[model samples]
Target: MKKHLIAITLILLLIAGGVIFYLAQGDKAKLAAGADTGKEPVFTAPRSELIPTINVAEVKVWTAGEKPVAAKGLALARFADGLAHPRSMLVLPNGDILVAETNSPPRPSGGLVDRVMNYLMNKAGAGVPSANRITLLRDADGDGRAEVKTPFLTGLNSPYGMALVDGTLYVANTDALMAFPYKEGETRITAKGRKILNLPANAPNMHWTKSLTAGPTGLLYVGVGSNSNIAEDGLEGEANRAAVLEVNPRTGDYRIYASGLRNPVGLAFEPKSGALWGVVNERDMLGSDLVPDYLTRIEFGGFYGWPWNYWGGYEDRRVQPQRPEVREYTKRPDYALGNHVAPLGLAFADKVKIGGAFANGAFVGLHGSWNRKPAAGYKVVFVPFAANGEVSKAKPVDVLTGFLDADGHARGRPVDVAGDAKGALLVSDDVGGVIWRVTGGK
Candidate 1:
């Protein structure tokens, strides 16, 4: 009698599992059919008009100087176009490029309402036109070119940074830390996973994309931007905004890893030292030199003062009567990029072995500056790290440039950078709506 009961239960369980699998497959088919079909997508959050990345009518190769090929070592091979605002990129283990389009325009160009919408979002503390889907591009045929395209994930809220852990995909979406359950060869995000954690305060009255990176231990770290450039700064109000939070994808457990960082857009774990590193975009509206963007290692519970002190000893007069009691422990950034140079994308380049100046260095994509008297940072630069994984009196080399033209105009603004499984660095341009994959080292 007991054996008979067990057999019946086993048969029922098998049937239920098969049904779930069939339903999942059907859902993927429906999602893929809708993705990138140029159809209007429904959303869970409020929609606004501020699309930033411009989709070029044609893919053109641009060089810094008039000679077109003046820089022999550096060349931008445009991989794909028609992206709304390709803010962040994740090169998959299988060589497919996953691009997060942040705030792409509807009609493909700016409209009056769209511009107003963007402005209002910025004013109200949430800003920019953001992408709702993740795009997958593959050169499946190996024809020395890529012609295949597919939408991998959709309804993501301005997803910025992507980290693949074990088999799961962890995305840092603005206002939330999200996850996609996965396994090898899975086409769709079959499982919704978890919202994990929600961060409403990171809404950018200023700069907002909450980029994230996973470390060696399967721990996910997120970057939450400030409510405004350097306004009230939520010194004691919002705890996690303008800070980095380390998270566990499976369990949805989280903790504040660091604080007082204003918009740490890009983050990575050091290959040699196993330390967490981040590149931050400091506040604006002071002078070009007042608040310099920074790239530094993230220390737990460390404070890099914002709305008060910036780049170490430079006290910001705008936020006068600064907190005198809590100023001692502020750890100044190890190094500073040029003033107003918005450094965002970062990756520890141990895997990609390049010779010459950048043989043993990291690459940072400087998303061009806004409100600067002189425009700054529309290129990818290299910073050499010593044997100890620290910057040792090094200067940055321009690896990717020409986004700003001869007339000092910006063709595109770079947002994020990542290395492929083969060590090729990929740069995503939000302004140009394009993706450029840079391969260095054999």
Candidate 2:
């Protein structure tokens, strides 16, 4: 009886081995067949090569009559001659360009100090300067001529974000958000400035500039960056510094949409997925130690591990003492931009030009880096993404470079990107005080 049982077990084992061999052979045959049929690999992304899909664009180098237009890391346009330190820009429905000039108040100085009070010297000093208000200008034919130029709105502390909603212009000021009735292409702006939300903003801590974007959901999203590179809340201030606030246009109701952003400058929702996204400028003075600049989806109430952790599992010793507690729980960013590259403006390709390679892509205007000893990033990068909103397969291509010299000096810096009525990509440069348009190789 024992011999019979052993014989039966051997037979069963042989049968199992035969079945395993058969399955392996089948898999091999399928793989060979797939190779022959030119099918994509099963494990890899379906679309691996993320090429740009940009429409035909017209490039216009700014020129002040015979003299070339010039400035630095600024967004500017020829709205009107003699515009002072214009740094931000917006387009009205009627073809008017709103230029936000960041003018510093003249400091009271003694005569002896005034003579040595070189305006250039104060600028050379530190501390980010304040950009006060928006100046409206019009050029009917895009012909480098300002038909009208005037103050659309005034008395703003520091206006950074501008959006036109239902014939009303919403301005995101540093300390508060305000809006006024605005007609596109209107030569002058007379305001009955309505208060939208009063935020305790414009602190000297971590994040200062409050960027705003109107999402497809018809709600306004505001991004406020963190106060410090990696420090915990300052003494008595546990303010909502690094958060994205959602505001309703119809009812003026506002609340925190997302949290834990360092300094998000540009915000836009993916047209196809309705997913919120932003171009964030990471913190400075960490010796390239912590988080990289990132372009990621803004999930509600998500903490990006500011000052404590960064990227994926990288410990930031400067932000907190309990590194072990925060290390594993901290979430990493979707895409890791190179260190110290100050990414600023973002614009998703629109319907007019979103047909081909640009269908699911976005453009970023890097304001460039100053803290990086060598100072990198003075270009506009084109990041192409998959249709499902995943960033892994996205490619960061240099849509525009040539701004920095080989020896590490800045030639130009991009401020913002917009798709004009004709489906062309227009980039505004504050440093050169000009608007440059870019077109695909086609």
Candidate 3:
């Protein structure tokens, strides 16, 4: 009788294994939407899955003398290496660079599903402890490498975005926005930062990158993401989430600048039109090609829809207690960046010293995706714009490639991009722990 029971258990285990393997086949993307930018991205109907397609790239750090592939007439070199998970960057007037090396804070109550996702995150090289500090990198000689590496500011929360206005250096930590007095050419900041305002950050901060950009008019713009994907945590958890906030640095007053962005990551102002723009990572689990991440010129009092709708007025049926009235006012994005590309960095090339196509466009650093089959976006791309600061109807050009090898292992993952004092493109790679510099070809 015992032998019969063991035989039954083995049969059941084999059946379950076969079922999982069949589901793992998942859905394959039909189009290379991530390569196409501007208006009119091809969208497909949502195909929900019982288990999300898990195809995360294995993390393999660069061995030595290995680097990414640059575009034609461009070259790539290591700016600074051997750093912790570098997420964002800021270039000072005196030619020094500040890199925020951080990751998500701990969420002890993330529940069972969250714990499972955390295990996957660890496998993807993003499970390291948050450093909670900013480091300074100086390429004073302009040889495309930083020689002086020092801790600029120490002891902070999970910091992401950074900016310098007047004589104050402002940092957007996960829970609050803080500022410190600054002087040119200083290697370290000894003063304690004054909290300008508290941000919407509790545990289970699913989207914790608080991107910061300074407006020309003494205001700071911050990008905050929704707490849960499609409001699974209820509407009460989304007070200031999924919106951009404008804050007056002098007076500490703040208000919602724009609403309904699912996960706005990179923030920038188009140099010609002076319009504020952002790169948002849209919701996932809607198949490999359902929702496209986007780039848009953010407007005051705008709603792009969250749990209620997506991509203009396409309602997501999975969201419960849906509000149909909100669909009437859902604003469409200016451009679609394709599905699951996970665009994390946005920088304008108006003043970049580098010539050719990169001189007058937007450079986006796609951090790559784990949810999509036959993975997309593990490199940096450039999108051209017209003189009027409007995006052209051209496909995105690959500026940096080779982050993934033939077997889909990630050597590095780009998180944020910026321009250095010399107008060269700077990319922060969080996984490989290096900052890459791109310049005109030799």
Candidate 4:
């Protein structure tokens, strides 16, 4: 009789699991990637799932001669290879390129969900330890390939963003803003760096990449992401998180430039207006297509709703202790880059050599998706801009692709995009461990 009871219980559990799996796959995206873009993204009724869709592309190393496909009139080449998880890049005035070869810091505890996600990251090849160094690549002959490679800076704590203003070089680490004295054409920096200011990086630093950009106003803008998805760990846990910080280079003092940005990874300034802009990664678990990541011209003392709302005024019902009043003032983003694209890099075409439609626009490195079926954003795309530096209404055009093969495996994952002095575009592929250069077609 005991054996019979055990068998019945097991059968019931199996049936329940089957039903859950079916529900998870029931809601497919009703709109295409283009439809869910622009100033107004198509937002469906939030379908909360007990288990979020898990569709990460398996990581595969790029075999010899394998390269990402550049768009028409452009050519792709391996600028520098065999790097360790390069996440960001900076082009020096003297033509040296600095690559931040790093990854996330140790994750903090968040319960069973965190453990499962960590396991998935391990399987996806993102679980490797952080390299924690910046390397320099130089193409002395302007042949579009880096021949001289050297370790530029070492002993970093999962650095992501880099900028050089005047004679000082700034690096945004996972926990703090650090600065080093820099000289033009120098291959490496052995001098110790000083911590300018502490960032919001407590345990469970889920959104770990802290991107930095130097503004013409002498302020350094740091993009710090939220600690949890929609403050699942409680609102009290989100102090000074989910916001852009403006730091004074001289004194290390800082203030919140803007708030309610979930994960503003790429910080940049619009060329014509000089307005600060960012590409933000929104929250998840609200179906695959509900919340779209966006590119926006950031406003000082502005709020782009996060835990309480999204895309201006759509309340997320999931966040507890709702602030309905705050939704009244939530600022809408400038443009949507589709949902779950995980946009990690943004750069404007100041003096673009890659002509045609991409001559004067923004280059976005979409880090790809892991939550949506038939995944999105495994490439770099160009958003055209008018002469005044305002993004045009045109849809995004592919600049670099083929990161995922026909078998749906990721040969490379693009993290950051930048333009070198020669006007060629540079991309950092962390998973495949390479730096790809894109030049204009002959």
| Model 1 stretches with alpha carbons more than 4 Å out | 1-71, 104-128, 142-144, 201-205, 233-237, 440-442
- List model 3 lDDT by residue over 146-213, tens digit each: 99999999998999989899999999999999999999988999999999999999657888989999
Model 3 has an lDDT value of: 0.87
Point out where model 4 deviates above 4 Å.
Answer: 1-24, 108-114
Root-mean-square deviation per candidate = 17.8, 21.3, 4.3, 4.5
Off by over 4 Å in 3: 1-24, 32-36, 109-112
Whole-model lDDT, model 4: 0.87
lDDT of each: 0.65, 0.59, 0.87, 0.87
Better of 1 and 3 by lDDT: 3
Model 1, 115-195: lDDT tens per residue? 444443343222445658888877677432358667888887767778888877887776678777756554456467578
TM-score between model 4 and native: 0.93
TM-score of 1: 0.76
- In the range 1-442, model 2's lDDT, one tens digit per residue, is 9999768765655564354334323111112211211011122111111111111111222345522222222222333445544555676666567767653333333333232322322322212255476887666677545666677777787777877777878888776778888765566667668888876553443355678888766688888777665455542453666778899877779888876676777888777778888877765544422235878888887777665555545555555454567566655667655555678788887522633655567877877654443344567776777767665454466666766644453444577776655455566665555556454433
Across residues 1-442, which tens digit of lDDT does each residue of candidate 4 receive?
A: 9999768755655564455446567656777658877765677888887777767789888997999999998988999999999889998888899999999997643444454566668757798899899999999998889999899999999998898998999999999999999999889999999999988788778888999999997889999999989998797878888999999989988999999999999888888889898999998988877789989989999999988999988998988988999988999888999988899999988845788778787899999988887788899998877788787788888999999999999999999999988888999999999999898878
TM-scores of the candidates are: 0.76, 0.72, 0.93, 0.93
